[model samples]
Target: MPFYRFDHAPDPVEKAGFSPEEVPRAITAIGADLVAGMGLKEMGVHFHRKAQLIFTLRGIVRCEADDGVWIVPPRCAVWIPGGMPHSAALSGAVEIYCLFVDPDAAPALPAGCCTVAVSPLLEQLLRHAAHMPVMYDEDGPDGRIATVLLDQLARAPVEQLNFPMPQDPRLRRIAAALMADPADRATIEAWGKRMAAAPRTLTRALTRETGLSFGRWRQQLHILIALQRLDQGAAVQSVAQELGYESAGAFVTMFRKALGKPPARYLAERRRQDGNGAD
Candidate 1:
């Protein structure tokens, strides 16, 4: 419910005099206080530019950053690069834990935000780091956990779930319409008519702006919608119908072709991996 802001980097290093060993302890205290009054479901948006790793203990959270959008479900956390603008929206009540690390220590991490799967070992490590004093010795359990968290972060895999936007106004309008009704199933001619552009011109615009033909763009839109529904826990049959697929089988094929996995399997894997650490 309450949003707290921490700007550690701005404070003078000598006056603040916080030792690197105490980082985990400070992180733990912050995590405990954040969860004290609110469960996962009650957590609100908390944004910071400082490099940090956020792990979800339960529930899901949506994060939007400069690089792209991510769905952070339980056991998953998002690694945000220093200076990247990012924000979080709770998907449901969840126990969200975090570790703010010095960017210099994690050189293998991406320079931008990315979602990472958190292993069970990493989860416990984070919990341990949450309580260690801000100035504790680096040889302690807190320090070891910090070292492991950084290692897990380096080995984390990034998943892509972003749909790039077209900048051209003509293509943008058509894209907007498709997003508004993913089940429209309109041909290029029909969409061109609605947009007051010649079908040929519309096709060229789409190709130029998105590097995809009209049909491909529409298919991608459908896939995007299907993924959104799946993330929200919709059944494959229902999602297929909602997206105007002729049958669940057709939707499965499309999902498989686009993402290399069936809808159910993809969603299940996402849930399982996300519970471990996904963004």
Candidate 2:
């Protein structure tokens, strides 16, 4: 697996440049050389010429785009549209299965960054795609695999695992503080006072910038960081407390609410799809 490293990015030491001529007419999968749990300290925001699926094969990878940051666990993929600047981090041991698809070749792929849920069938298809030669026959078995993959990707559920970051300086300050310590469950009024901004002003900035109210925005941050910690093998109770949850059950409820499953159940399923249980 070879990962393209681009020189345009000051970080993510690994990069490569590709043009449409460099890729297949449809989808091309490159077994990216991502190590388990190793991340580029900082990969300056960059984009791909082709829409990319940063699919996690093992462990977790966290990525940040212009709009938000997402923690991608096993069997989870971050779908980034072509030309969308984004950067990624490997919080823990993480392996990547990269798929680059031309929108002209597969119109069903989303034009924005999204967290895609990988079904069992889709995962297998992606596995096959990863092993495909750079120039696979479009009219052959690989072509059929690519076709099914597009359908699966198009039909895959869009999961709410991303936390959109606010761009306003004041809001960024507030967001930064909360992300530093999700357990700091302070009131908006209190936070505003600490930041020397009016509560009303803070609320307006948060809503206008991120389209998320102050409270919802904080919860979103909590979700993003909590997933990172949990994926690193933290105990549920500890993670709950770390994120300001009253108990493990409270954290589980929130996790289920946002992602439709508790940490244990989710990780179990991840492991099952991760080739530990079955192919």
Candidate 3:
């Protein structure tokens, strides 16, 4: 669903613990574990005064903001800047940690929505921060921990998990249709006919709005879906077939080409990292 209205309520920190602004500290970390079948599945469009880092050790969290959708897989976090309207959806069983930081607390952090790699130390910091008092002393050891957390977060390497969404209404329709049925292996010409536009016009408009060609953009969506599905424990063959790939090998080739690793290796590496620090 597209973001329509801005939600004027407390930030998501309230679900895990306390609200971010109620505390006098620069950051507030809270953790929540959501299992499948829970009544909660999506968060409405919302914005807050503090920036947020949505990190997950298990399952997946997808956030939409800044005209793009970002997926937080294992060992990564999606960073949403302060006052940027956004919404999030959770899949499967999710153990997520959200850290809300004052806008001015970390000058080095990215000022936009992006996914960043979470190191073992950074993951532990967030996990530990969740247990900290809402009003941690700025001059004490907890304060020092907060300083380290911010430092690590600032230096966290960004990942390429952002799927830019086109703003044009026609392009948005195409995007929505493709996301709804990823297995639809239609060409640009076919999509153009479906959208009542010339293939060249669709191509040019998509490239102009998203900086990616039609094929690349479609493949990007496939990659994002593949990542989310793999993270959810779907088998490679099933995921490949589900995405309309002729065979699992074809899907592996595409995944390896796009992500620099095959599905099994990529997921294994992430699970290794998680096992190293995950409780």
What's the lDDT for all of these models?
Answer: 0.63, 0.74, 0.83
RMSD over all Cα atoms, model 1: 6.9
Residues forming the 10-long window of minimal summed lDDT in candidate 2: 5-14
Worst lDDT run of 10 residues, candidate 1, spans 1-10
User: Listing every candidate in turn, what is its Cα RMSD in Å to the true structure after a full C-alpha superposition?
Assistant: 6.9, 5.1, 4.9
lDDT tens readout by residue for model 1, 205-250: 6777657788777776677567656776678899888888899999
Misplaced by over 4 Å in model 3 are: 1-17
Candidate 2 error regions (>4 Å)? 1-21, 33-41, 269-277
Candidate 2 TM-score, true structure as reference: 0.83
Give me the candidate number with maximum lDDT.
3
